[model samples]
Target: MPAPFRIYNTLSRTIEDFAPVKDGHVGIYVCGMTVYDHIHVGHARAMVVFDAFVRYLRHREWDVTFVRNFTDVDDKIIKRANEVGKDPVALAGEFIGHFHDDVGALGLANPDHEPKVSETIDGIQAMIGNLVNSGHAYEQDGTVWYSVESFPEYGKLSGQKVEELRSPDEVPGKRAPADFALWKAVKPGEPAWDSPWGPGRPGWHIECSAMSLGDIGETLDIHGGGLDLVFPHHENEIAQSEAANGKKYVNYWMHNGLLTMTSGQKMGKSLGNVINVRDALSQFPAESLRLYYLQSHYRSPLPWGPEALPEALAMLGRLYEARENAEAMGGSEPVEQVISGLGEDAKKVFELGQGFTSRMYGALDSDFSTAQALGYLFELARAVNRLANHKKAKKRGGPVVAPALAAFASVAETLGLMAMSSADFMAEVKEKRLAAMGVSHDAVEQLLTDRRQARADKDWGRADEIRNQLDEMNIVVMDRADGSDWKVRLVAAN
Candidate 1:
């Protein structure tokens, strides 16, 4: 049986139990990129949030059909193609490939269906035809425009009254200031398609309406997008879809908050302060980026700073180290018996481990509180670390820590954290961070060789000196009981 969960609906502005359009199934459509450039960290947050939500719903046995679209035909793509002296379709295809690379590196699952405006032209035109036939829209000089005044519920979703709205100046053929274009007449040097009205392209908002209705039916269980799109984008979608279908557009609306810079401005491509996902992945492991996104409530405006990824890397390292310590523990006895012998630390680990799943589910089910879920994981880590400090832990505490060990495994399977082996994770951190810092591998290897000789010759002073030099270079040398190992330290440069 699927678990019951509640989500914060933007339309209702309240948390309510999710009742699907069809029992045991959810149809979700999220607004995807415009495909004009590489995706950035802010964009990745929306991607990861929706991806994780879908993963959780599927994990809980809910049948979910996730649809995310690509705006391959848009003003941005056209302008960018013109600037680069390339066909707009070809330029969009280039950025679409880059989008896949960036999101794939961030470990996002592919949507169940990824529709595009270029491919969904027929559907878009068909929807516009319906609106025009139903008298909800009209054509002027080959352009189709939706009469926003015809929909009495225009402000229902956005809570903005038409009279109160400051609509843009009337365009040449639009009937009213608020009547948005359903289809734009063909423009020079742009992608075009045949339609009953004329040869034209889909408008920005109408594409989503057409694609969602065509892919998942007239009403979606949940329609999601960034908060910034609530006004003109989502509001327009509601008008077009409802007017055409003569039914509800979406049962629930979900909007994620934008990532804000430290200066309080939003990180957007238009803002020119965006950090590209490709650049971020080149500097840090994908998990570090994932951690940075999941550390906050999905609906809260997350602050991006010089220390964002570094802080997240530190948090991820803590969880991995705790898991490693738990895995290293050893014992052969009943858990209760071992706990009784090992005292309070063992008992704490045992109790917290037993309750870990419940706490995780509580956080996840209640508005997908990733921050709270991680708090519980950190609590488990602390318990494990405390138990590992016991002198007998390595040889005689495995049975006691078994549940704690299982907790980490569950986290890996469920949340996609601490999924890599310690050695592999550290190696990836070194390679990515050092490469990002422009450090040469051969130079570091020679320094390590010199340090090894000093240690072999019992020149402890010389060995320490070389280690300090490497430290200054942002390298950390770990003198293990077996030998010396080195890694590039991940921290905020600023």
Candidate 2:
């Protein structure tokens, strides 16, 4: 049986039971990008959060059908295309391809279905026609407008009183301030499709209504997007979808919180504060981005700062070090015997490791509290490290840490964290951090060579000087039995 989980519903404004329409199955639809430009770090958060959610669900044995759509033929696309002197469709396609590349670099899974607006035009028109025939929409000149008054429950999703809204733009034939456009009459230069109402294209909200229904059904198990979309975008979706289908549009509305700058303002391209995903990934491993996003609760506002990624990288290094420490232990003795011989530290690690899977599941199952789940992981990692400090731990401690290793594997399978081998992770850290800090590996290598020669010749003062210089550059030189290996340290968070 698939494990049960709880999720906070934006529509109900409370945590609710996530009952699927079908047994052991969930159909989820998330609003995707407009495909007009590169995806920023803010956009990457939504992508990573939802990707982790689906991966977790599947890890619990639930069959999930996830659909995220691309708004390829939007006004923004047309406007950007005109600015760049390229065809709108070609421009959208270019961005869509770039989106895939960025998503891949960020280590995200491909959504089960990525429906596009231009490709689904026929279905969009059909949904519009259904609204018109059902008296839920009306034709105004060549454009179709959804009648907000026709649906008494229009404001239930967003909780905004219709009368409080601004007066509708006088587009020559629009009836009311609250009634949104269903199908826009195409402007001369914009992309056009033949419809019963005339030559026009889908309105912003209606495209999701049609594409979601086409991919899933009349009602989705969960619908998700950024918290910013809860206003006009999601509100309009609920009205048009439920009004036209005569059924509940969605069982749960899940909106991830937006990223906020340290100044308490939301991150946006208009503000010139956006960090594109490519730029971020070029400086750090993909897991650094994932850790940075997952460290906070999904519904909480994530604060982006100069030390955000660096702090996350530091935290990640801690986990990797502990895992490596545990993996390095050598023993074949039974765990009970090893624990009996090693005392409290061993006992703590064994207990935490044994309970880790259940505790982790408990945290994640309760409203997908990734922050809480990661709390358990970090605690286990600390326990492992503390146990490794025992003198006998190197050779005789493997049995005691076996369960902890299993716990790490479980985390990788379920949460997609710590999936890489320790050596690979450590190597990636050196490569990205060196480049990010503009430190040349060759220069660091030469310094290490000079330090080794000074040590070989018993020149303590010269060796100490070289090590001190490396420390100034945020590098830590570790002396292992094999040799000296150095690592670039992440910045400490304030």
Candidate 3:
């Protein structure tokens, strides 16, 4: 049987035990990118959070059907395409390609079902027809609008009163201020689809409702998106889906928090502070970005900073180093014997490693507190490093740290961190950091080569000068018995 976990539901505003519609199965649908532009770091948060979440659930043996949709025919895409003098669908397709590239580089697992509004027009229209037949929606002037008053639970998801809300728009066809369009009428120059309400694209909120139901069922096990979406978008979804289907829209509403700047402002294109995922990945490892997000509670607003990736890289390096140290040890004695012989450091590592799985489960099961779960891994890493300092640990500590190794493997399996081998991790770090610093890897190697020759010739002063020169570029030169290796060092803030 799969392990049970709890998740925070935006609808109830409480963390609740997750029970799937079908036993041991989860059906989730998350609103994906609009595909008008490349996904920025802020967008990547939702991508990474849900990706890791699905990874975690599957790791615990839950059969998950994850669906993330693309709004390929949105107003934003049409406007952007017109501005760029391109066909709307073509522009969206271009950015969808870019989205895949950015998300692929970020090392995210693709959602099981990546539905698109353009591809699901029939399903979308059927849903709108259902709403119209049910009297929850009305057709006027070739446009269809959902009447908010028809559904008394209009603000149940967002907890906003309809009377207190401002007019959604000053559009002429809308019956009430809160009435939102289910099918938008054709405009002068925009993409149009043939529907009962005439030629127009699906409204923003209706796409998710239709897609979620078509991909999963009338009710989704969990519907997820950014916290920023909880209001009009998700709230309207609940209204339209339930009102039309006569069933609950979703059993659990899972929302990840937004990424905010140090000034407490959310990153947005309008703010001109959106950092594209490709640009961030160009300078840092994909895992660094993943760590930066997982370092905090999923529901906490992550503060994006200049040093966020660097600091996360340093933390990741520490975990890798500790795991590598534990892997370097050699022994086959029983774990208890090794622990008893190696003293408290060994005993601490053994107990912590033994207890780590349940503690990690406890944290992750309770609203997916990734930060708390990572804390346990960090504690285990620290214990491993401390124990490696003991004289006997290197030779006989393998038996004792075996469980610690398994703990690290569990992290890789569960969280998708530390997934790379230590050698690959360090090499990629050097490659990316060196590229970011505008330093040549081969040039650094040549310098190391020169430093080694100088040392061979007993030219201590010359070798020291080369080492100092490398240090100036934030590169650390490690001289070992086998050979000398160079690693790019992060700035002091890291």
C-alpha RMSD of each candidate structure in angstroms: 1.5, 1.3, 1.3
Off by over 4 Å in 2: 492-494
Which residue pairs in candidate 2 collide?
168-177
Where does candidate 3 stray beyond 4 Å?
Answer: none
Candidate 3 on 279-300: residue-level lDDT in tens?
A: 9999999999999999999888
Q: Give the better candidate number (1 or 2) by lDDT.
A: 2
Total backbone clashes of model 1?
A: 1
lDDT of 3 at 152: 96
lDDT of 1 by residue, 423-477 (tens): 9898888888889888888889999999999999999999999998998889989
Candidate 2 per-residue C-alpha lDDT over 120-166 given as tens digits, one digit per residue, 9 for 90 to 100: 99998988899999999999888999999999998898889999887
